[model samples]
Target: MARNLSTNTGSQAVGGRRHTVGRLVHYLLASPWRVIVMVLAGMTAVAMIVIGPKVMGEATNVLFEGLLGSMLVKMGAKPGTSKQAVVTYLQSRGQDKFARMIDSMNVQVGVGIDWGRFGTILMFVIGIYLISILVRLVQNFLMTRLVSDAVYTMRRQIEDKLDRLPLQYFDRTPRGEVMSRTTNDIDNISGTLQQILGELLFSVFSIIGAFIMMLTISPLLTLIAFIIIPVMALCAGVILKKTQPQFTRQWIRTGQVNSHVEEMFSGHMVVRAFGHQGKAEEEFEERNQELYQASFKASFFSALVTPMSTFFGNLSFVIVVIIGGVHVLNGSMSLGGLQAFTQYTRQASQPIGQLASMGTMLQSSLASCRRVFDFLDEAEEVPDIEHPDHLGQETGGKVEGHVRFDHVRFSYDPAEPLIKDLSIEAKPGQTIAIVGPTGAGKTTLVNLLMRFYEIQGGRITIDGVDTSRVTRHDLRSHFGMVLQDTWLFDGTVRDNLLYGLDEGQTIPEQTMIDGAKATHVDEFIRKLPQGYDTVLNEDSSELSQGERQLMTICRAFLSDPDILILDEATSSVDTRTELLVQQAMNTLRKGRTSFVIAHRLSTIRDADLILVVNHGSVVEQGTHDQLLERGGAYASLYNSQFTKGEED
Candidate 1:
């Protein structure tokens, strides 16, 4: 048998891949102040790092010049004599700057070398590094805060979006996949923002700063170092392109795996009862293996980037050393300058290597971002009308629960009209029972009534006013629904009962107990160890299905909605329990219009109006006695149930 939930099984694909990345970039830059501060801090830190090696080279030169002068003086020449000799020697070599530097060194005279000056320079270098560390600390802090805030905002937006999205979206999309987007995808983005943002800024600044410093030291060495850049870039690009799709597949497969696991776990009892555990395991293994393969391929390809980049970087270093050595020996460059140039070469290549390694991580993050943004951009529910009509007290009137579906037309698929030219009206406080076979658009009617879906044509009205003219919040506030599947979150019984109450509206404890007592939920609550305070887990498996249904009935009672919809509300309970629930429902339905959808004909036998719906349109409708006397579709259905009961 086919399942509606599995219809959309495939990797989520967004149109225009580059556009998705662009959107992600736009979102990241939405906070200009944070970006600006991060850039400044990173650049300052890289500047300090780039300049440090140069300062060390200067210190080396000072030591070399000082030692040379000290040795000359020790060999019987006076300090001034040595300094003058050094100046003449430098001038002879066509080095005017060195000659002037030697001339300036004469201030040290008999001292020969200034250890204090060298110490000061070393301390200054250390201070620069310390300041860089401080700046980076601030940058990390800022990045953490920024990423956290962005993720929080994204989560909040997603939550709000979920609330506003049409129910059809969820019907088509898997809950586990949605969970993956909300959790795994968003987490991926968060990790990237926290880690990659800092690394990216540093890499860019390091590359630029290193390139400039290398050029200043020796353009020839800079040229040699840059020779490997294009090669490394091409390699990284190829690897990234291959791995990008794999990463996308990986996350998709991960979501699929999650979906399968969640489904299996949630239905574990059914699987076991039917002895389908092996089949479930086999299916899970298949999905898990696919996920494994995708992850392995993505990681394997990405892993190649770092070693390949390192090899090229090391190759550049070797070439630079061989060439720079010749320049130093030929007296075209000083030994200290050559050392500084070598350091700059490493600095230049380091960023390229870092970026190469980060390429895979960045792509993965982008993929997750695209998935998250796709969800955020999903088509929302139709917006409420401008200047919506106020429904209740605000409009100086009460909701009378008079609902009319006028020339109603609808279809899940536009090409196939399920319900067409249908019309129905329910007077205030009347009981309307809709009976139909499965897939006969029974629930779809309730959905339309609650505005969970929009009608393609015609209109639904409440109290003679078009429902579309009222905000969904106002429209839905008038309805209390008890679905076939009872949804009980993890909370105490009292909390679950009070979940329907509006915020800041306190329902007294006695009132809650009264509502529960009316629904017979208090009987089970008193039997529990913790009574009404007993905590329920996610599935609420602690409570029986009948008990859970009673809790839902109590919730509906507490809500005191102007209109009520009970779709198989008592289908799960025993006959006796059903009677008690029906009694409570009757009490709750007093003075409120109610729409009851039931498969068991006995349940709605006393309804004020019985609607026999077939293939989405009413075949027959009348009061129970009138329908029976007419011997129409309703009579056939009611008699079939009566005959089946006698046979049983």
Candidate 2:
């Protein structure tokens, strides 16, 4: 069932389209002007190439008429279309008559060539060159901007989605794979889009114009060009059919490499302690080699395309020349006309090669699209419901500090229930301690209360209001949490503390200092040279473990939550720090309902109610003294801890 759900999620994210070149093109075309400019520029350039040669041919014919025939006719001699007539007239004409003809013809036919036609063709060629360059420049600029914007927007969306994704999703998807999608995969897609659109789009336009020009110049040559199309198509199809799967495999290998590297970095302490440097290197090399092989195969097939297309292009050129030569010798074609036809053939072949090369780009982009959409489509763990009733005035003035869980059952995986049929109630201004063996779902209970994970079986009510009906943001914001690990962003202590405060609430220096004192954190803050304004380093190594915990606790106090949960808040601190923290916890718990999870046993001795949980069930419940007197699980637990403490 989980597998089925994941599959459905993947489909939904990517819109369930098969990853293919065509689809990749669709994504690129998402920025319409980039594609439009490239296509139009290319089309116009080709049109210029085709028409330029024809215009030049016309200019050549005009030159021959003016120089050889028209001049002779003006000099008192007959101008004939036939070669024999011209020869006869030349042989019979006297020197004076020839001079007169030259004089008269010079006036009638000044300069044989059509200068206007020649000039116009030259200008069109120049104009086409300028337009092509301009279009290319614009296309490149826009495509760069577009691809950058697309990747930036995409990464931002994925980051936002990651922030919202359920904690369980992180357990299944590796950090490295997610990182690769944002960085490496995005880079690859960007490169492909730019290269394909910039170079290949232009090549395609040139080929189209060349083909049409060839057809108009000589139908026989155009027919010869058609023969090579099938060959180019077959080659592209065969290469693509083999490379598409290889490209997908390549991306998977990339993910594997990334995952391994990230794991090595995050678990360096464990790896070093175990002395597994050699083992880690060996594993990394294996993954790296797999990536290399897949990448090589994908690239090798892509590389074959241009050469194959060129071979067909050259072969077609050979055929066009041979057929055209025969027509020329048979007096059916001109020298200039044949020259233009050959140029057109070369031009026509280029687009086919470009279109063929586009195959590899398609495969790569399709894979990236699939990955990107997969992230976008993943189920949001907690959704901010539309028009959710605000918990504002409904809480009836500052929450009343009452919370109830009615037969709440939840499972990370349905097959294995983590918290089953659990029910509890906490009165206003009460401190409730939850004690259990590790994995007794202690943290899971807190998770449910915070609405981080929804309960599958029963409803949790806060101030007699069902939590499901309220906005998760408002629900969580009303509570404060200080966990075993303190999360300190790269900022000043004051900034981190201020993060918890509500908008428009000015944090006074005395108020900030008092909140820190309540958590017993002010001592450390005072010792720092910059006090509250001291900036945390990237590693946050400047502060001790206990100091960090105190800072987080102070954050909670400053927020003044109606309810609080401290999950092993003192677990990492030393004995001296624990005493300080315990004092802070006691002071902060006043007039507020609190849920405390502690391993030390001593921290929660004063809890108004002690609930002993074992194997996801509440086995014992009462005040600390009452549970100890009953001599059940709580009594046994306290005794064990006391014995261990005495031995220490």
Clashes of each: 0, 1
Tens digit per residue, CA lDDT, model 1, 232-291: 999999999799889889889988998888888888999999999999999999999999
Among all windows of ten consecutive residues in candidate 2, which has the lowest summed lDDT?
101-110
TM-score of each: 0.92, 0.85
Best lDDT goes to which candidate? 1
- On a 0 to 1 TM-score scale, where does candidate 2 land against the true structure? 0.85
In angstroms, the error of model 2 at 284 is 1.6
Give the alpha carbon lDDT tens digit for every residue of 162-246 in model 2.
Answer: 8888877787999999888777787887777767765675676676667677777777678878877986898798898788768
Q: What is the lDDT of residue 534 in candidate 1?
A: 90
Candidate 1 residues lying further than 4 Å off, grouped into runs, are 1-17, 67-113, 393-397, 644-648
Candidate 1, residue 117: the lDDT equals 78
Q: What lDDT score is found at residue 470 in candidate 2?
A: 85
lDDT of 1: 0.85
